[model samples]
Target chain A: MCESIPKTMKAIVFHGPHDVSTEIRETPKIEKADDVILKVKYSGLCGTDLHSYRGHIKGPVDQIIGHEFLGEIVAKGSDISDSEFKIGDDVLSTFTIQCGICWYCKHGYSGQCDKTNTFGKVGLPGGQAEYVRIPYAKSTLIKKPASQDHADDSVYVLMADIFITGYYGVKKIVDFLGQKPAVGVQQLEIKDATILQYMVLAPLGVGPVGLCALRVLNHLGFKKVVCVDNVPSRLEEAKRLGAYKTINFETEPTLLKEVIEKDTGNVGFDAVLEVVGASAALKTAYDSVRRNGFISSLGMGHEPLPFNGLDCYLKNINISFGRCHVWSLFPEALEIFETLKGDFASFIDHKVSLDESKEAFELFDQHKVSKVVFDLTL
Target chain B: MCESIPKTMKAIVFHGPHDVSTEIRETPKIEKADDVILKVKYSGLCGTDLHSYRGHIKGPVDQIIGHEFLGEIVAKGSDISDSEFKIGDDVLSTFTIQCGICWYCKHGYSGQCDKTNTFGKVGLPGGQAEYVRIPYAKSTLIKKPASQDHADDSVYVLMADIFITGYYGVKKIVDFLGQKPAVGVQQLEIKDATILQYMVLAPLGVGPVGLCALRVLNHLGFKKVVCVDNVPSRLEEAKRLGAYKTINFETEPTLLKEVIEKDTGNVGFDAVLEVVGASAALKTAYDSVRRNGFISSLGMGHEPLPFNGLDCYLKNINISFGRCHVWSLFPEALEIFETLKGDFASFIDHKVSLDESKEAFELFDQHKVSKVVFDLTL
Candidate 1:
C-alpha cells in the first residue's frame, strides 16, 4: 500500500478569497494513532465550500479545500483495528470529524460534538486531493458497498453531507408533525389524523440540498411537492424529480405565499422545507405554511430573520434549524442510497477534474450547475 | 333559580384605553342551548386584561372585563346534558370558549379552535360580574371540588388562564427537553441523558403568569429557579414560592445574559420561560439560553421580536410560542393544585369588591399589586 502511494499529490489549495489553484502538496500521513490515509476517488463541492472560497468562512491559507469525498483506505495507523477498517476498503468521509464517544455523538447529535472539526474549512486538512488523511477514522469513515464501482459513486459522495442534511430537514419536519420514528413501524405514522396528511410540500432553493430533499420527499410519497426557485434549470430538474408544481419567484409577480396558497387550494402547504439561508425564503416558508404547519429550516443565513411574535404565536408554526448529524444517520442514508439506485445521480449535473475546481466554484456560485463533483482520477 | 336571578348586575366594563368603569348592566342569560349562566364568586385579573384596558387588544365597548373566574352555575339552558356539570355546581371557566368537537379541540389543541373566543376580549361577554353566560359549558367549564370553599378558590380561579398559561410555558420547555407526560409517570423524566439536566430556569416578567410558572417549576422539583423582575414585591413573592435567585433588572448594572451566566456557573440557563411580551425580554431569553436550550414564549407581544436567526441557528435553540391548551390540561393542573394545596394562593395579593375593579386595574397597571382578584359578593 505504501509503495502504491505517492510522495506528493495534486490538490486544489485555498489562499484566501477567490484565490484557489491546483498545487502539488505532500500526501497526508497518519499523524494520530487513529488516523488513516485515503486515496481520494471523488469529492463534491458544497455551499459551505463556496463560502470558504469566498472568504465568508475564515480558515487557514493554502489548505486543501473540500469536505465531501469518497475514497479507498490506502494505509492505517497501528491503532486502527482491521475489524473496523482495512486497506483497499471503499469508504466515504464525513464533512466533520466526530469523536463517537462524546455526549453529542452518543445521543445521535454528532454535528454538535465537543471536538467536532470540519475538514478543508477550519480545523483539519481537506479531501480535494489525490490522497487525504482521516482522523478518528473509526467514526468518520463509512464503509461503502464493495460491489459499487466508481461509475455509481457520485451519490455516495453526497452521503458525506448534503444528502443527509436534506434528509435531516425532512426528518425534522416529520418529527415536528409529531410522527416520531417508532421501533417497529416500517413507515412514519401520522400521530394526528387531523394533521392535513402532509400532502403538499414546498422546497425553497432548488440547490443540491433542496433537490435531495425534493427527491427524498418524493420517495416518501408526498403527493404534491412544490419546488420553488428562480433558476429555470433547477425548476426543470425539480419537475423531473417529481415536483408536482414549480414556482419561479423572479418571473412571478404574485408573492410565493399567494401562489402557494392558490396552488394548494388556499389552505397553504402542509410543510415547507427551507434550504435557502436567506430570510426572504424563510419568510416565504413562514407565510406559505398553514396553521399548525412546520418550517424545517436547514439553511445557514447570517442575517436575522424578522419573526412576528403574534403571527407565529397565532399560527403555531414550528421552526427547527441545525446542522446535519451526518455520522449518526449514515447507516440509514446508505440504505436509502442503495434503495434509490442511481436516482440521486441525476443531481450531479457536472463532474469536473480537480484542476477545474476554481472554475467549478465560480460556476456553482453563478448557479450554472446543480451539483459539481471533483474527479480525483482525472 | 329564575326568581333569585337579578335583572341587572354591577360589573367592570371596558369603554376604551384607561376608561374602564363599574356600571350596572343587564345580567347575561343562557343564549345558546349549551350555555350556562355562572354567578361569579371570584375573578382574577391578568396581564391580558391590562392589555385590553390599555386599548392594545380590541373588544366591544362596555363588555365585561375578566376571563379568569370561579363561580356557581346559577342557570343552565335546556340542552345542558353533561353529567359532570349542573346548576348550583361550583365551576371555573377557561379564558377561551372551546366547542370540544372542532378538529383542533378533538386533537388536543383547543387553543387553536376556529370558533375559539376569549372572554371579555373580542366577541365574547366576560365573567367580571354577578352573572355571565359561558358557551359550550361542557368543554369550557371545570367543576370545582365541593369540598373547597370560596376563600380557598384563588388558585382555582387561576386555572382559567394564568396558571395554565404558566404551566403551558413550562410544559413547552419540558417537551422541548423531550420529556412528554407518560401514562403513569408522576414526574417529567429527562428522556435524553446527554441533555443537560435542566437545573436552572429563569422566568422573565414576574407577573401572574411568571409567578405561576415559578410555582409549577418548584412543584416539578427544578433546582436553582431564577426569577427576573423589576418589581421588588414580585421578587419577594417569587422567593417565598422557591426561587433560588432573583434579579432586579431595573437595579442590576449587568445585562440579563451576563447575570444569568454568572448565576448559572458561567453556563447560561438550561431553559428560559419568556413571559414579558416585550422584545427586550425575548432578546434576553435568546441570549441567556445555553446551546441546545429552549426558550418557551407564552407572552403576547404586538411587535415582532427581533430574532437573530444565525445566532439561534448556531446555538440550536428551540423557540416555541403559542397560547395554552387550557382545556386539555385542566385535569392535571387540578390534580397539581390539589397536591400543592394552598401553595398558590400567595399570588393573590389583593382582593376587592367589584366596585373597586377600576382602582384595582390602575394599581395592577402601575405594577403595585402582584395579583388582584375581584370578589363579586364582597
Candidate 2:
C-alpha cells in the first residue's frame, strides 16, 4: 500500500496513429474531488484501441491509451470515503464514468449522460500506465470478489465495457422483472404484452464488444448467443465464452435465416446486437430481427447509418444507435463477474508485461490474441 | 313470408379490363346450410375493385365485379335460426365470408383464414348483382343500426375495409379498454429505474390505412397523430381526421424527422404505424420513432425490407407487419360507426349508380375521390 505519491511511472502513450511507445512520465495524481488513483494491475487491448492505433479516432497524441482495465486503488480523493475501497483494494474501472446523479443517470441511462467522461481519450488518461486516474470513482470502480484469485478477474474485466453493453441490449426487450405472459400474433388483445424475446447479435467487426456480448449473455443466463463474425479465432473465443452457436458469414451468407429458424422456428430473433459499425452489418441486423424485436449497436462506425426508414416502419422494428454510458451498468456487470467467477477470464488468452507494449499491440493488430492483458506487476 | 327461388337476376358482369356490361344471369342459389341470400341495396367501388378492372387481378373476363355492399336479407339457409338477424334485416357485408370454426376464424383472424371465401373473386359471384349469396352469414354480416337513414348508410361502407384496418393498427399499439394502460415506450423501465414518457406516430404514405390511423387515434383519444404523406389530398384528409400535424414528404425529403420533432418535441414517437408499404416509407417510420418505441406496419408493399438489425436490438424497439385481421376487430369498428354515425361517414365523398362503375373506377384510379359508393338501388 502507498501513502505518498510516486514521482515516475512506466506507461504506454499513443503519440499518433500507429505510433505507440513506452515512456517514463510523472505518475498520475488524484485531481477531481471524486477521483481515485489506481496502481494499474491489468489493461486489456480492445477493438477501439485498434481504431485509435489506426488513427480513426479524431483526437490528439499523448493520450495514455487503453480503456479495459483491472487495477488496485493507490490513492483516493478527499471527498471519497468508501469503506469498501482502501489504498490496496483490488478493483476494476468502467471505461466511461458518470456522476450518477444526472438526469440520464437517474433513468439508468448513465451511458448517455451529458457530463460523462471516457478513459484513454484526450480528456482522460486511461489505464495504460502504472498509475491511472479514475473520475467519478465511487460510481466507476467495483471491488473484485474476495473468494476469486487475480487470474479469475481477467474474464470479468469486460464488466468495464462489453458485458454491460450486451445486457443492456437484452434488457430493453424482455422485462427482466419476469411478470406478465408473453404475447404472440394471436393474443393481440393482451395489451402491454412485451415481445422482446428474439435477439440478434452482430459481431460484425470482431473485438471486445462482440466477445463481451457472448460473455454477458452467458453471465445473464441466455443459453443461445448467436455470434456473427468473419474471423475464426474470435468466433472460437465466442464459443468458449458460451455462445450457443457461431455463424461465420465467410462460409454461410444465409446465416440470418439459419439463426432465425434455429431459435424462432422460422420467424426471427426478438433482439439483435450489432457490435460492428459497418453499413452492411447494420442492415443485416435490422433484417434478421422479427416483428417487435429490438437491436442494440455499440460500435462507433463513423459512416452515416444507411437507414431504410420505410422498411423499418413496415416491419414494426425499432432502432437506436450511438455511444454507451459505461458508468451506469458497471456495478451490475461487476456483480455478475463476482458471482460467476471461473468463466469470465477465459477470453483472455495472452498475458504480457507493461514493458512489452509494442509486442502486445502487434499481436492485437494481427488478430493473434483474444485479449492481450498487461500484467503491471513489473 | 313466402320464399321462392329465382332462376335469373340483373348483374353487372365484366367483359374486359375497362368494360363492364349489364347481363342477365341465374340468381345465386344457397348451396351451404350456412349461406344466406342478400337482396343487394347498395354496393361500393374499392381501389382494389379498380385494380381488378385494370386486369391487375387474375380472374375470368366474364366474372362478377364488386365486393363492398349493403343488403337486405331475403332468404336464409335451413340451419340459420340465430335471432341476431331475420328475413328482412338490412346489413353490411365484410368482403370475405369466413367459416367461424376454421383455425384462423376460431382465433378471430378470419382475414388470414386459409379457406376464406372472398366475394367478387374467381370462385364467387359478387355483390354487383341484384341478389348475392353470403356464406357464414352470422360471422361476416353486421346489421345496420336501425337509427340511421338508408342514404346515410354509405358512410358505414368503410367498415368493410379501411375503418376496421385503422382500428386494428391503433389497437395493436394502444390498450383500448382503458383499464390497462397503453403498453408502449412510456411504460418501459430503463435498467432498474426511470420511465420514458411520450410516444411517436409515424404514418408512412397517407393512404386509407394512414387516414384510418388518424381517425382511430381520435376515437382512442390520442392528442397528437403525426401524419406523413406525399399526396396533398391524403394529407388534407389526414388533417380532417384529427392529425395533430401533417408532413408532406414530397416537399421535404427529411419529413420524417420534421414530423417526429413537431409531434414529440424531438424525443421521437412512442408508437408509429407504417401504412405505406414502400421501402423508403418504412425507413421513415423507423427513423422517426424514438428508443423503445413501437412501430406497426400494415402496408403490403413488395420489396426486400432494408433492415438494420443491430440498431433495433439495442434500442428495444418492437415491430409487427403484414395484413390486419379485419374480422377480429370489426365488431369494435361497427360499434364506432353505429354510435358515431354522422362523425364516421364524413370521410365518404363519392356516390354513383351501378351503371356508372366505369366513372367511379376512373375517379378512384385518378385519386379524384376518397370513396365511391355504387348505388345498386338503380
Candidate 3:
C-alpha cells in the first residue's frame, strides 16, 4: 500500500469566488490514530460547495471543496484494525465526522453529535483530490458491499450525503405518517403497503435530494406524491424519478391549489417533504400542509423562521427539522440506491477530470449542469 | 326530559371587561337535531375565558363564558339515541365542538376541523349558563363512566381542557421518545416502562396543564422530570401533583443549567413540555432543550414564532403544536383523571355560586386564585 502511494497529488483547490484551479499539493497522510487515507477515484460537486464558492457561507480559502467522495482505502493509522477497515478496501467517506458515542448519535441523531466536523472545511481537506485523509474512519467510512462493488462512482458517490439525506427525509415522513418499520425488517419500507391506503404526499424541490425522495417513495410503491420545483428540466427529472405528478412553481401557480383540492378534497397534503433550504419553499410547505400535518424538512436555509408561532400552533403542525444523520441512515439509503441504480444513473450529468474543475463548478453553479462529478481515475 | 326543564334559569353572564353579573336568562333549548342541553352543575373558569373577559380575544359580550363543565343531560334533539348519548346521563363539555365527520377529525387532527365552534361566543353560549345548548353533542360531550361517577365536578371539570391539554403534551412527548403504544392498548402508556431507562424531561410552567403533565409522568413512573414556573404556590402544587423537582423560573435561573448539567449531564432535556403560551416560555424551552430534542407545545400563543428556522433546523427539533383535540382524547384523559383523582382534586382552589362570578373572575385573572369554578348546584 505504501509503495503505490505518491509524495504529491494533483487536486482542485479553492481560492476566492469561482476560482478553483488544479494544483500539485502534498498528498494527505494519516494524521490521527483513527485516520484513513483514500486514493480518491470519484468525488461529486455538492450544492453546499457552491455556498462556499459564492462566499454565502464564509470559509477559509485555498482548501479542497468537495464532500461526496468514495475510493480505495490506500493507507490507515495503527489503531484502524484490518477487520474494521483494511488497505485495498473500497469505502465511501461520510459528509461529517460524527462521534458515534455522543448522546445525539446514540439516540439516532448522529448529524447533531456533540463532536462533529464537516469535511472540506478548515484543516479537514475535502475529497476533491487524488488523496484525502478521513479522520474517525470507523464512523466516517462505509465499506462497499461485495454485492454492490460493481456500482462504481456515479451511483455510490451519493452514498456519502444526498442519497442518505433524501432517504432520511423520507424516513421522517414515513414515521410521521404513523407507519413503523415492519417487525424484523431494519430498512424503512411500508410492509404490505398499498398506494390506495396511503396519504397524499407533496415533496417540494426537485433537486437531487427531492428526486431521491420521489424515487424512494416510488420504490415503496407509493402513488400519491406530487413534486414541486421552479426548474423545468428538474421537474421533468422529478417525473422520471417517479413523481406521481409534477408542478412548476414559476408557472401554473394554481397547480398546487388544484392538486390540493382535487387530490385531497381541499385539505392539504398529509405530509410535506421540504428539501429546498429557502423561506419561500418553507412558506409554501406551511400553506400546503393540513392542520396537524407533518413537515419533514432537510433544508439548510438560514432565513428567519418562515412561519409565525401563532400560525404554527393554529395549524397544529408537527415538524421534524435538521440535517440528516447520514451515518445512521446510510445502510437504508444504500439499499435504495442499489435498487434504483438505473433511475439515478442520469443524476451525474457531467464527469470531468480534475483539470476541468473551473468549468464544472461554473456550469453547476449556474445550473447549466444538473449534477457534476470529478473523475479522478481519468 | 322536557317536562323537567324550566323556562328561565339563573346564570353568570359576561357583560364587559372585569364584569360578570348574575342574570335570570331564558334557558337554552335544543336548536340543531344533534344538539343537547347540559344542565350546568359545575363549570371551571379557564385561562382562555380570562382572555375573553379582558377582550384580549374578541368575542361578543353578554355571552356566558366557561368551557369546562359536566352535568346531567336534561334534554336532547329529535335525532338523539340511547346507545350514542341520551338525556339523564352525566356528561362533560369539550373545549370546542368539532364535527366528527370532517377530514381533520378522521385523521386525528380534530382540533382543526372545518366545521368547528367554541362555546361562550356568538350563539354558542358557554357552560357557565344553566341549561346551556351544545351543538354536535355526540362529539362535544363525554359521558362520565359509572365507575367514575363517584368522582365529581372538581376532578371532572379538568377533563374538559387543561387535563386533556397537559396529557396531550405528554402524549406527544412520549411519541417523540420513540415509544409506541403497546398492542391491544388504546391508551398512551409506556408498557413495561422503566424509570431507569427514561430520558431526562423538563416541563416548563407549573400551571394546571403543566401540573397534569407531571402527574401523568409520575403515574407512568417517570422520575427524571423537573417542573418550572414563576408562581411559588403553583410550584408547590406541581410538587404535590407528582413533579419530581420544581424550579421557580423567576428565582432559580441557574436551576435549569444545574439540572441540565447535573441531571442530564449537560446534554439538556430529551423532551420539553412547553405549556405556557408566552414567547419567553418558548425561548426558555428552546434554550433548555437538547440538540435533536422534542418540544411538545400545546400553548395557544399569538406571539410571532420565537424560533429562527436555521436554529430550528440545526437543532433538529421535533415540535408537535396545536390545541389538543379534546373530544378525541376524552376517554384516555378521563381514564387518567380517574386514576389521579386524589391528586387532581386540589386543582380547583375556589368554588362559588353564580353570584360570586365577579370575585372568582377577578381572583383568577389577578393570580389571586390558582383555579376557580362556578358551582351552579351551590
Candidate 4:
C-alpha cells in the first residue's frame, strides 16, 4: 500500500531551543496493527508549537514539530479495519489520540485519558512531515467533510486544535452561566434567562485561540462581545471579526477591569475568556467578571496562578480550565466550520511552504502574524 | 395590633469583640410598608454569628448576634396582604431579605440582590430577641408547612442558615459534576451517567453545616459519603447520620489526599463539600478531588485562600465557592426538611433559655457543642 511513497521526505525538525530546520527524513510507515500512514496536506502553527520551539515545553531532539494537520491516508497495517476507514481517505487527526475505551475517554474527557498521547510533543512523531504514521487510526482519524477548497480545508485544520479549543472554552462559559438545579421544574427557563442576561462576553489575548473564541461566541448570537489585546493588528482583526468593542491594553493607561466596567455599565462582563495563560490576564478576567460569572481559561501557563480564594469565593466565580479534548467536539466543530463558510479564513494572515516554517515560527513568536498555515502542497 | 405588643424586648446585643450581653432594647416595629413583626420562637447559632461576636465580621456595636430563627407573625403593616401570610402564622425568615423585584432576586440569586440585607449583619436587625421585624415579608418569610411541632420547628430554624447553606453546597457540587452541554440531545443521559459514576463525596469539617451537608447528600442517594474532621464527637455524630466513612484528621498522620485515594481505590472523591473556612481545609478539599471533580466551598475565610492555580488547571477541577444564597434553595430546603422529620435535630447538642445564651456562645466557640438553639419558650 505504501509502494508509491518515497522512503525519504522533507520534514521540519525541532533540534533544540530556538532551533528548527527542514531536513530530509525517512517517511513514517504503519508501525503497529492499528497504525496508518498519512500523506500530509496542511499543518497549522499553534502557540504550543512556539512553546516547544522555545524549549519551554521540552521534547526530544530532532523531533518533528507540528500537530494540527489534514491528510490523505496512504497505507494501513494488517490489523486495520478498511470497513471503518480505508486508504485514500482524507482525514484530520486530533493532536491527542485517545484509546476511546479508557475511563477518561468514555466519560468525555479524552484529553485526560491514561493512554492519551499527543503528536509533536514528547512521545509521538508530528504531522509537519511529508508523511506521518497515526496510531489508533479508527478512533483518532476523523474523515474530513467533503468540502474540497483550500479555505474549507484550513477550517478543518483548525478543528484539530485551536477552533475546538476556542469553542470548548466558550461552551464551558455558557455552561457555567446556564447551570441549573437538577430537580427544578423551571430549570429550562432559568437556563434560557441566564444565557439571555449573560450575552456580554470578553475574550482576552486576541491570538488565534482568542480570535476563534470571539468568532464562536459571535456566531452563537452573543451580541456584546469585547476583545482585549495589547497588539494593534490582532485587535483590528478582532474588530473585523465582530467584536462589539476592542480594548488596546498597550495604549490604555486604565486597568482592563476599569475599561470593561466602563463599557458594561459597571456590571462587568458575564464571562471572560482568558486565552493568554498568564496570571495577569487571568486576574483581569477575574476582576472583569461580575458576581456569579465565569472565567474560561484556555491558555497553558506553567506558573502558579496568583489566586485570591476569598475574592473568588466572594464573587462566586466558576472557572473551567484545561486542554481541549478536540475529539469530543469534533463533529460539532466540523458542522460549525461548514456553516461558517470561509469566515474563518480571515484568521490566516500568513501561509508558507514547509521550507519557510522556521521563518514562520519566528514571525509567529514575534506576533507578526495572527495565524500561519503551512501549505504542504507547496 | 400595636397596643398588645410590648414596646421593649430582651435581645442579645453585640457591644464589641467577645462582648455580647442580653439587654432590654426598643422592640422592632414595621419599619417598611411591606414589613411584618414576628414573636421569636427558636433561633439557631451559626459560625457567622461567632465571627460577628469575635469582631472578625464587623457590625454595629449594638447589632443583634443571630440570623437563623422561626416564629409566629404577631403584626403586619398595611401593605402586607394576608393572602399568603397573616398574623399568628408560623413562619421562618431567610437570613437574606430579598426584594423579589430586583434583577438578582427575580433571576433566582436573591441573596445577591441590590436590596438584599442579612439579619444580624451590618444593616439588618436580627431575630435573637423577643420579637423581630422582617422586611419584604411576602418574599422573605416562608410559611411553615402544616406538619408543625417544636422538633420540626427546630429543623426549620436550620433552614434560615446552616441547613440551607449545607444543601446549597451539595447542590453546587452536584451541579458542577452533572454539568451538561448547553446544546446537546444527550444532556439528560450524560448527567445521569456523571452522577452515577461520581457517587463518592467528601464533606470536610463536621460542623453543623458539614453535618447538614452529609445528611443532604445521603438523602440525595449518594451511597459513598466520607466525613472528615478533627473532632471525635462530631465524627461520631457524622457516622450516626449516614457517613459511609470517617477520617479524623487529628489522629491520622497520612495526608487527606492519600487517605481519600486509598478509600476510593486510588481515585479521589468525585466532589468535596468544604464547610470549614480555613485555608487548610480548602487546600485539603482541592487536593482530594479527582480529575474533573468538583469542590463546592461554603466556608467564609477572612484570609486569602492559599491557591495553586496551575494545579487546578492541570487537574481540570471545577470549584464553586461562595456564601450560600439560602433563599435560592428555600423551597426545596423546606420540602427536604419536612421529609427529614426530626432526623436533623441530633445536630443540636445544646438547647438553652435566652438568659443562658452567653454560656451557650462560649460552649459553641470552644467547639464543645455541635449546635446551640435558643428555646424562646423558656
Interface RMSDs of the predictions, in order, are 8.6, 7.9, 9.2, 4.7
TM-score of 1: 0.86
Model 3 chain B weakest 10-residue run by lDDT: B180-189
- Cα lDDT of all candidates, in order? 0.77, 0.67, 0.79, 0.77
Arranged by TM-score with the best first, the candidates are 3, 4, 1, 2
How do all the candidates rank in terms of lDDT, highest first? 3, 4, 1, 2
Q: Which of the CAPRI classes, incorrect, acceptable, medium or high, describes model 2?
A: incorrect
The TM-score, computed over Cα atoms with residue i paired to residue i, of candidate 3 is 0.94
| Per-residue lDDT of model 1, residues A1-378, tens digit only | 478888889998989888888899998888888999999999988777777677777856878878999899999988888888889899988888987765456656678777899888656889888899999888899788766555567667788898888888876665565632111101213364433346455588888788888878778767578888888988888888888878888997475656555665565776888887788888888888876667888888777775778877887666777788788777766667676747777778889898887799889888778788898766
Fnat of each candidate:
0.30, 0.07, 0.53, 0.31
Q: Pick the candidate with the highest lDDT.
A: 3
Worst 10 residues of 1 chain A by lDDT: A180-189
List model 2 lDDT by residue over A281-366, tens digit each. 77777777654445666555545455444454445454545555555555555566555556656667888888888888888888
Clashes of each: 0, 39, 1, 0
lDDT (10s digit) by residue, model 3, range B1-378: 579789998777888777788789899888889989888888888887777678787755888777888888988988878887877898888878887766666555567778887787776788887778988887788777676356555568888888888888887776666633111101223332355446545477777888888888878767778888888998888777666778886898798888788877787777888887778888888888888778888887778777777888888878888888777677667777787877877677798887888888889899998888888777
**10 residues in a row with least lDDT, candidate 1 chain B:** B180-189
Q: Write the per-residue lDDT of candidate 1 for residues B74-183, one digit (tens) a residue.
A: 88887877575777888888888988876566556678777899888667888888888899887888778666555466667788887778888887666665632111
- Binned by DockQ into CAPRI classes (incorrect, acceptable, medium, high), candidate 4 is acceptable
Q: Score candidate 3 by lDDT.
A: 0.79
Clashes of 2: 39
Runs off by more than 4 Å, candidate 4: A54-60, A148-152, A181-197, A252-265, B16-18, B52-60, B148-152, B181-197, B253-265
